[model samples]
Target chain A: MIDKPFNNKAWLFVLPVFFLVAISAIIPLMTVVNYSIQDTFGNNQYFYVGTEWYTEVLGSSRFHDALGRNLLFSGIILLIEIPLGIFIALSMPRKGFWVPVCLILMALPLLIPWNVVGTIWQVFGRADIGLLGRVLTGLGVDYNYATNWLDAWITIIVMDVWHWTSLVVLLCYSGLVAIPEAYYQAARIDGASKWKVFRYIQLPKMQRVLLIAVLLRFMDSFMIYTEPFVLTGGGPGNSTTFLSIDLVNMAIGQFDLGPAAAMSIIYFLIILLLSWVFYTVMSNFGADAPNKEVG
Target chain B: MAQISLDKLAHSYVAKPQTDADFALKQIDYVWQDGGAYALLGPSGCGKTTLLNIISGLLTPSKGHIRFDDDDVTLRSPEQRNIAQVFQFPVIYDTMTVEQNLAFPLVNRGVARSEIDRRVADMLDTLDLKDKARQRARGLSADEKQKISLGRGLVRYDVNAILFDEPLTVIDPHMKWQLRTKLKQLHEQFGHTMIYVTHDQTEALTFADKVVVMYEGEVVQIGTPEELFDEPAHTFVGYFIGSPGMNVLPCEVDKNIVHMAGAKFTLNKGYADLVGKLEIGIRPEFIDVKSAAEANGAGVAIQVTAVENIGRHKIVRGTVNGYAIDVLTDEDQSIPSDAYAVFNTSRFNVYQNSHLVRAHS
Candidate 1:
């Protein structure tokens, strides 16, 4: 098909957005790209270091450990949150006075700032003065998030789940309510069991929204930083050191700008590639499957 | 398969209905025979859907009972009632193929795999969906999706009655006739007790053995389409049923004579002691336009206003003593400026307060 000729005047409407994106994204990205390819010293002197920082970051055991931990954490959170959110949303009342009440309660966790959430969990997991730690310790369990690597990981994961699961619940709830009442009535008249109704009717209707929820949760969990940083501080022997935490420690703490910049680009590319894969696979699912004749 | 009956059935959305207007469906008592096709005909918000929902056991009536055969199923759930309902909008399992959607009801009821396959295959052919049988229901057009919905209702052989609440409302005008004909064919072949609800008179007249005409939450009359058109029980029915509906004009009843628009006509039955607002109703087809001299003693004089030729016939509209009157005539029949409108006395119906007046003992 022949393409329509472009209008030069259409560029005027897009110039503001292009300028905003350049200032907000491309300029910072180019700075990262520039740093990734060069080495800088204290006297405003620099040396071109091509592919060295990239190779160093790629071969580092620290990066590998952090990447593995990040993947594991995101996977675990998704496994817990998606189903739990759906369950909570399904159990919620479909209408009347309780709807607003339930919605407000579900939105409470999301309204809390990320660092405040981390700080709250940090204190809450302390065995010395925190209520949860005191109760667990009182229950005769050895629990201390400050010094124990496994305990620190557990606390951070729990904190992440508590902070973000509501987002999934809200999205799923909107999807559930959007379904017309006729579907349920039809299912009932058709003699469909509760499980069949949920599996076939409700789930399919909620697919689009669930796709959005899954994508948002995946991206957010993959790049999770503030909460874990505050709660675990990449401490308890690096057990809770996720990818973002390691990047921040390298770039900010140790001032290893070259390796950190290379790692940042790699991180961005990984997120972009994974998101594309997720979008394509999910959108193609149950869409235009080859027609097979029955009988 | 089953005779459905509603006994003094009434429903209201409000918890405590204090007035008759509060009831979505006023008291209704009727029985639909087994293996009969009936239509609940009414304008929107006339309780046609409310009555359908009540019969399908989707909504529990605030008062009275519903029975299938000899069993009182008023409190039973929809599944327990064994009823099928096709909504105005098509409802199908979007993720499933056409075959799967048709088989859903049978699968839910735990029918044998062979039986489900056979029924699904049959429904696919019957709905003319054999070519699209394997396609996902989400990809089908509105009419095709609706056909799938209808197939789901028909796939279950054990259903007591199939209730349709304007099932063809969303179908295209051209496809509507085809689906309606298919529905009639299915009803005749299967001998199922089908109650189709619609506001369209043509649909009601064509698909139903009996049309129950409802007005403002109450059933005005229940009869064959011919009976409803010929003898409307209430003035609302006269106004609602026919195109260019019956003209109901204010009149004065005196002994055996009815005086209307400064003209006098004799009644077949006398109502000497009738004490209410009197009116006479006649269909436009029963009125003839004649010259003033020829209709001197037989008709009332009218000032002609407009004549509309509607392909098959012409509708002559005029004023009889400042009241609008319509007369349906052959297309070749020419109207005059000052014409006398003559009523067929045999087809004349008198109403006392919006209800037909029948002679008493």
Candidate 2:
């Protein structure tokens, strides 16, 4: 073990970042807590409401719809990305000059700002000018994402999958490469079929990275606001109004600060609770995950 | 339980060899008798492991025909070949218990439960892994993991042969000696056709009945350990099979006497055909050492470079007849700065153009 007297010195190193987080995060959190308990009238008049808005938000139908929609979106995103990413990763050649080229292409969308992706897709889906809409209309299919709830949901899910599945593919590919060739040779000598080799050897070896892919995809999809906000604008009658977008609408558009603050607290708690559940399930069921693949 | 025959087996990693310079494994022919313990011994990248993988059906020979017990298996997969292989590193399943790992192949083949249990139990007892049978293999030490791998290889009685690719490499030195002994005993008990591949001469010599010495891409010699040490067929074999290796010196043969460094050494026999391009080889153990000049004491004078006391013997590293040589003597033997080194002519061998010309004078 390292001697602790390396000492209060390491604490000094972390002090700057800690202060920055405290100012930007902790101060606003304290303000939210204050709002949770108190209400104000027109001219800075204050009256203690003490959890009334919290109970109200908890019972609100709009809050329930946002929460459910958020969950459905996260579930759909994870379902689409994990297997599709693994398939792409498996189909790729193990070694070649094309490997780095393929990797850079996969990473292009990830490096772009999320808002820019939204802009690109928004213009790309315009029926009058964009290619996708032009192609679909040219094919004699009636498609309007802005006017139909089904089209809006399908478009949002597709955008999320295209934007995020590469992350999963890259992680799973790294995990697969970490497996030693000796293991594959042993499997071959054992007379294992191709399916068995994949099920028993490759899948178990990739469990740890698969866990990271699952959690990351879940959290990002649940809190997704920018792309759907720009593309569908939570339109076609609230079909794509995930919790993150609903929270913004309540806090800024409607200017209902107290209720939105309560909703924000609830949203943070829900993300925390769901993430904890994912962690517990993965640790218990997939406890034999290959953590030493890095080495 | 089966004889394995490889007929005209050849492999080239490239499309074509330009001037016969690039074949990884040249065309070769050999047969392994059933229930024989054989070893393919060679240094690294000599195609020994590649040949082992091919025979195990992990790699199909680019051009060849393979037969197991008179049945053509050249186009078969590893499953159809009925061969088990143990690798250099431990390859047992980490998630399974030792018993479970040994029983995996048997269960996959739909063997009855009772037979699987009986076989697994027997293997556990044979490997001395009964205590670890219930424990997860992931937590076991490297040696223990290797024991599990060996047990898995031996679990099925229907396998035609068992191939080992330097399986004791990860084992500790002290355990390596013990494991090699255990493997030899297992072969004797089961009467299984076994082929082990290793670069270590001691491991090959002490454990195998027949040793195949390979160099570059071809088997240079195949004989019993005694034959390999007593008469190495190739120069590479002569150097690769012994710890200190054989000492080779360029010499000119005059009748029965070989002349070099302005000195003449008499041989036990005469070889008139080997007059030019002659090289003489002497085992380090067979080189006679002396100190004084009298009678037959006029030995080859050598510049003694260093004398090393290695437990039971003193290895005298020096230059004799302008050629580097090492002569082993008793620990108490005093090697002078300039000493007399003489190889017993009866123990000498003469080579012409890298092939043995005469074994006796």
Candidate 3:
């Protein structure tokens, strides 16, 4: 009933979005592509390199290391955040005077600007003045994120968990609330054990939101740079120099704009490819669920 | 077989019930004989649903004792009660197949695998969902999902009772009748103790052996459909158990005569000794339409308002003594502009203070 004739006039309504993306994204993307294929010599000189930068960047061991670290961080975050978030959402109260209070408290961290999280933790993990480091030092433990690669990694991992666990919790709580009470009643009558209820009903019902949680956490953790950058300065012999950090170091520190742009394009492509896989899999799972029911 | 009994049951969702109004469900005592089919019929916000929840052990009553087959189970959980409940909406695992959803209860109880398969297969065939047994529940329509809920309830044979809370509300118009008929057949075959709760009278009247009509916080009357129709024990019952309800006309009762609105009418008997609010109730099915001057049958008179001619019958609506009445006539019956409704005197009952005056009936 809601379907109407497909008119070309609809293009007029979408023109603004098309132009906005083209200017902000398409143009910059074209510039990166141009830089990947071309070489710029000193004093405004130029030469055609034709995929030379791509071969060099792909051959670099530093690129491989950064990609491995990125994948590891995303995997760890997903594993820790998803189940922990579901537990917290399940234990939360549904309706009462304290419901809004509890929700507001959970949301306070999500709204506190991502970069500010880095800065706050930067001062927070300091040995001399930071609360965490001061406590650790007092406990007769030697901890210095600035000098030790292990300390840097743990600090980044813990910081990422603190900042982004709330997002997963929020998404999961919404999914839990969306479940009708009838399902619970059904579970009760079926004499389903508590674990069975969680497995067959609660877990399956949260699939869509869980997918969203995974994608958001993966993208955020993979692209993470600011916190580690401010906390350790990619220090201890570049042990924590993730892709984004290295990209910044190459472009601004070493003045290698061509290679940096090429690396940026490659970085953007990796995220795009993985995200597309996730979207396809999630949507396919959704469509396939119903068809199997009736087929 | 289980005979469910409630002894002096009362519930209040407050710290203390200081007055009668404080109770959400007033003190009620009742019983359902083994294998009896009963319906707790009431409008929304009435205590019928709450009472059902209490008996199901979803809620413990503030003051009561409950028994199943003479076993005191007032402190029992829903698990301990061993009762099955169907919800208003379909509740099924969208990820699981239809056969799996039906088999879930058995598997949870660790029933024998072979028996589980047999029961699940039988249910799939009964519900006509055999073709969909392998498909996930997500693809099924609303009615199909509801049928799964019902099938899951019936798939088990050892449960104490099956409770339905308006299970047909979301079903399609055509499927509602079929599902109701199916449920009736299941009851006849198995004789499971079933307590159905519904606001719709058609469902209650046709499905229940005894309809427990509830109003506000109390059970007003419980009787067979014929008893409720021919002689309503309460004004609420008379106004509830049929389409168009019964017409309640305020009347002044003498020994054998009644005065209403401005006209005098005669009945077979009268209730001069009846106390409290006096009124007469007659079902739409028993009332007949006649010319204004014709006066053979005994009952209050009326003014014809509108005529709705259904294919098989006509519902001729009118008002008598400032109270509304509807008379059913054949589709071909002519309704005069000025008509007098003849309320079948023997079928009518006089209510005093909302309760039936038995002496008059």
Segments of candidate 2 deviating more than 4 angstroms: A1-53, A96-105, A126-131, A134-142, A286-295, B293-296
Q: Which candidate is the best by DockQ?
A: 3
Name model 1 segments beyond 4 Å from true: A1-6, A289-295, B291-297
Residues B1-361, candidate 2: write the lDDT tens digits: 6999999997767776664447777778999999999999999999998899889887787788889989989888877888888899998675667788899888778889999999999999999988767776676777888878777778878789999999989889999988888898999888889999999999999889999998888888999998888787877788887768888778888668888655788876888756457787777888767775521566788888888888998888888766889898888876655478876777777777766775443
List of chain B TM-scores, one per candidate: 0.97, 0.94, 0.93
Per-residue alpha-carbon lDDT of model 3 for A170-189, expressed as tens digits?
Answer: 89889889899878877887
lDDT of 2 by residue, A4-94 (tens): 5656778888999999999999999988877777777758786889899899999999999988999988988988999999989887777
What tens-digit string does per-residue lDDT give for candidate 1 at A190-216? 889899989998888888888898899
Question: Of the pair 1 and 2, which is ahead by DockQ?
Answer: 1
Give the alpha carbon lDDT tens digit for every residue of B59-122 in model 1.
9999999999999999999999988889999999988888889988888888999989998988
What TM-score against the true fold does each predicted structure earn?
Answer: 0.95, 0.91, 0.94
Candidate 3 docking category?
A: medium
